[model samples]
Target chain A: MSSREIDRIDGSALPLRGDNIDTDRIIPARFLKAITFEGLGDHVFEDDRAAMADHPFSNPAYRQARIILTNANFVSGSSREHAPQALNRWGIHACVGESFSEIFRGNSLAIGLPCVTMSAADMGPLMDLVERAPDTSLTLSLSDRTVTVDGQRISIAVDAAVRDAFLAGTWDATGLLLDDFEVVRGVASRVPYIRGF
Target chain B: MGKTLLKKVWDLHTVRPLSTGQTQLFIGLHLIHEVTTPQAFDMLRARGIGVAFPERTFGTTDHIIPTLDQTRPFQDTLAEAMLSALERNCAEYNIPLWNLDSENQGIVHVIGPELGLTQPGMTIACGDSHTSTHGALGAVAFGIGTSQVRDVLASQSLAFEPLKVRRIAVNGTLGNGVFAKDVILEIIHRLGVQGGVGHAYEYGGTAVDAMSIEERLTMCNMSIAGGARVGYVNPDQTTFDYLRGRRFAPQGDAFDRAVSWWRSIASDADADYDDVVEIAAAEIEPRVTWGINPGQSVGVSERIPATGDAGTNGAVAEALDFMGLVGGAPIMGTRIDVAFVGSCTNSRLSDLREAARIAKGRRVASHVKALVVPGSRAVLAAAEREGLDQVFREAGFEWRGAGCSRCLAMNPDRLEGNQLCASSSNRNFKGRQGSPTGRTLLMSPAMVAAAALAGEVVDVRDAL
Candidate 1:
């Protein structure tokens, strides 16, 4: 098996409930000027944490949580990979949400941070459970396609190809695409536009 | 059943199918910028890899480049370091770069089309999310993150699962003062911010066809905000007309041949789509975002939705609370402290012309600090040639340099604490305009011009 294979994750959950929690709120554009993503964890949700005293990221109860639970369309807007990098550096191994924006999901998957989804109806109870028991151990099993918390098994959805990438340990796509470099050149040669049609 | 442009382009670029059920697709063009490319290049260096097709890649400094004064070293050291890193990376990779001194330099999305690097029947990728803006030319463009950026840099390809196509047809003609910006805003309002997820939006119909190439770019630029990774308008005479004589466009007989290929790639008349959404152009009014997200908007004449009216999710309530606005309050007459017209969305020449038309002979309110930024140096030169700059200056609006000035506020140009702004840029996300408490009411350029004159949200039709 490849060393990068990520079949499961076990952790406490941090609940940040909201719709359309965009990347701007997660990291903000001001913090994006750095050449590298180092030290980004300290600034994740910097604005939100400063604005609201009760912001979940600033709460002490979820300080050690390795997973984030949020509402629909989580991590939308701006294809900044810094958002996922910040979360990854901030000790988040996974994110469970009602839905995730396409680019955000791709970015998360690229970094090996599984962003799984559950229906809104199913997510409400899970979020409530996490809020009630912040330290409750949550086990997300990609092999079983479920999240087990407090003896309750909740079915989750992962895009088939994304799940396959994780299970096969090919989530870092650069190597995979580079392996097919000749085929890529062949495809480019066949396209009329690429050839100055 | 017929094929869509997206399908045709996807098939044309597919290298092979992988075991993960993902297609390894070739990217025709790769656009890079400062903020997102530094780490991507670092990743390549760490892996001992080189840019596989450096000629296909283009770099420009935009995100961190200051608008007011773009000297060798920016006032902000981080911004300067980022730009310097981009220069070094592009040079090392043998990729052509349009730095601050380059006349062709501007927002990557704007310069791509302006330089004719963006074309129909191609697949484009960029590190910035607004890379979808190139799709206005009938290309299938995607905004990718840094790792994917590295993937493209090293392999000139990326793995992707196919997306379903949703044809959003807007019929009839747009009324006076309604623009492409308003139409897109209306589409986002009707289709919630997340509604277009997993779909590539094919924008067509009489209304969309009526739009100019720049307007189409404006419409496509915000596809990401609407949760769509890609959006496109099929290539037509309008597209051809705009491409003709552009710097990078094919010339002479090659141009004619290219057009035929572009025409062939458009969705067939009987094209099958996974879903279709219909919109009436006349029904779409001048829209303005009243809350945190772009979808949380209403027409200028409408009132903010109350808690009960918005829905049970409490998103609207939170927006209202954060925005410090009362539910059921009319969006019109909302006071504004700043006005800006710039961004990849509506910073082209046509956008400036529209804003200039509204600003002519009208003085900006004493309390309102208004600025108009061109999308590119070319757009600025064109505006200056037509005396548009004079019109804006005489009207008391600051005519600034070409860059993403107040849009994301990565540079010096930004809103102050809690300043409410009438903006023509895309995305009204909280803290998007730099200040944590800053508020952005996204509208058309003309609407922003009118708001600057009135010092509050106002109907551009009335101002006209």
Candidate 2:
């Protein structure tokens, strides 16, 4: 019904603890002037590159990886869509965190970046595995909601609705609204003074 | 059963239920900006529909207008055309406009409250997401699309489904250094951005009650991003006082009557909620955005999360690959090249005052370039009267005129290639500050001030 396109990404397990990861840092605000999200992967941290020349992203260990896992309170300021656009553009499958900010998470999800939340306790083993093998590439099994790196399973919790959405591949809430519109309208009309509203 | 503010406002505004799964809801106020209005106005012309109620509609230019060099025939041709179209449309429709020359000119959200157009117990609509900013005045403001914009223009009524309501109350006293911005950042962090989808947030509690109207406005403004169709703080003494001397607020006996009516509409003490969240003020801090989004943040005292420490969303391997950041770095000492203080988010006099307090008697780092822009001509005048401009200029901040400078970089004010800036404006998404490689660090104005002085991500308290 709207011009905005939506996507549904399958669930994945990711673990990382970083604070102050902002929209500029996520995709860098400078990339917004561009007509498209294409090629944004290079500028994800245009601000950080000048600070740390040999950053891991500059290294070759991680490539073609999608999805970001972080601790509580991910994406905190500004309602810039480029952050999620960049991640989604650059093959980032999804973002999982203990908690997420309102605007960042919404904008991300609107454009198909699934922001999944898991408990801290459930994320410990996965985080521990990453710490021990810093360069290890891990895979998250969405069917069973398990994270595995080098054959070892990692514990992580995910909400059922989010998991189902990921598996079913639909991120549009409006569809949900429309599906229940008849019932919602019926109930709304019954309420005095609300039939018109 | 808990009824949301959307339900209450919708019920009050409904003239009739439509067969198209939409209720015919009445709109008390309609706000418009430049970018989205042109097509709607054209559509109105095509349908031969003049605005049904011109008095209820207000217009301003923000999205496409240049903040700097606001002279005629703007540098961007598209922007210039949009501006002219808005002016032409406003004139033809007899709609009141707050053009660049008008004292009320600024972001649509900024001007609504100043003009007293946004008020308690009203349903407002604007062709912008941040229309939620008006909800602070206790109005249920909805962000509509161009078609909806046209609908309001042609009919003065819109069809809409109902929504549930959530009551979010923050009790206790907010400590100094922490602000409404931080409080909101904390809320978004805890609840996630989509937590309020299909819900209206009714903010209350001792802490919210104690906030100045401006502070409360900040909290409600970002509710749209959090997926709230509407966010409102119940009208009280604070709301009434803020509107008392304004142009649109009622006067004398009428004021008294209005206040009584306003008070009656607040959620009663026993009002139920579909959901309620309580956050302590003491837990909040002078918030800043470190990642490319608003929610990826922590206290100034905290360090960057280690890759592994980032929960399932951390995707350390991937973020580190893209962001060029390693795990476990200290976010505090991160160097910055530029510092900006302005935007609809935090460009008011109070915001300037806080930044000035940190900048006074301290020189910015030699390599750092700092800019201070007010939200409006009035805010500019107030800051000048208070000598805040001198304080900033003396501290090496470029004291510029009022506009949405450096917020979205539509003007000359922007970051160079890959320049790291500590910015008070909202949104840090890459290139949001203009340069294809520019980086923005979102923070409170005070934090920007502190960072300007240190040329790094230093805490404002440290500067204090």
- Highest lDDT, which number? 1
> In model 1, what is the error at residue B342, expressed in angstroms?
0.5
Q: What is each predicted model's overall lDDT from 0 to 1?
A: 0.92, 0.69
Residues B271-358, candidate 2, lDDT per residue (tens digit)?
A: 7677788888777777766665555567888766666673635444543444445457777888999999887778888889999999
TM-score of chain B of each: 0.99, 0.94
**Best by the DockQ measure:** 1
lDDT of 1 by residue, B257-371 (tens): 9999999999999999999999999999999999999998899899988888835358888888888888899999999999999999999999999999999998999999999
- The positional error of residue B129 in candidate 2, measured at the CA in angstroms, is 1.5
Tell me the tens digit of each residue's lDDT in model 1 across A60-88: 99999998988889899999999999999
lDDT, candidate 1, at B113: 97
Misplaced by over 4 Å in model 1 are A1-3, B310-312
lDDT by residue (tens digit), candidate 2, A15-96 = 4456445554665433444323457766765655555666544534334455566776576444455566566665677776
